[model samples]
Target: GEEAARAAGAGDLNVLIGYDLRFWRELSALVGNPYLSDFFHRLRVQSWMCAVPHLRRAGDLRGRLWSGHCDLVEALAHRDGRAAHAIIAEYNADSLGLIERLAGERSG
Candidate 1:
């Protein structure tokens, strides 16, 4: 997880995207629900496709963009559900904000 985060920080977007997709897919699979896993896989891929252009346009790839992933891994490893939820919430909000800003910049 930390290695993937570092790769992302170093501007290796493909590595970051692949790591994220695999992480989420495996995590969803842990729920033991095939339908849910499939749904999440499709949703994650679509989201990544929508964000790819904006992600590529960004100059700096460091900082919060790839942060929290290691912490999330730790939280999940320790079975801290609340901490994991908070991390996911923050990550989602931060990512959405970045994408929206990038999209707005491109459009306007």
Candidate 2:
């Protein structure tokens, strides 16, 4: 699951990943949709969920999970539209590993 998600997200890091800084500008450029301010609230919740204590217990699972996100976002935004969104969708779909890890920490 993690591998698949990484593969998906590896393709479209911009459109799907919200914590990425480039999310808004690229979004505006592509779909003419501006970044909604409320998105940050969701971002914090999602990130906090990922950076929880248990996952980070081994001194990992904390910090930035995907620092490469913005780079991919920028790359995808400048490329084709449908293709870019598809890649982003792949990334969104592939987020299962992070979710699993997060769930594991929550349960344990």
lDDT of each: 0.82, 0.48
Q: Where's the lowest-lDDT run of ten residues in candidate 1? A: 59-68
Q: Give the TM-score of candidate 2.
A: 0.41
Model 2 residue 19 lDDT score: 38
- Writing each residue's lDDT as its tens digit, candidate 1 over 80-102 gives 99999999998889888888788
User: Model 2: residues >4 Å from true position, as ranges?
Assistant: 1-35, 40-42, 58-64, 67-71, 102-108
Residue 11 in model 2: lDDT = 37
Q: Which candidate's TM-score is highest? A: 1
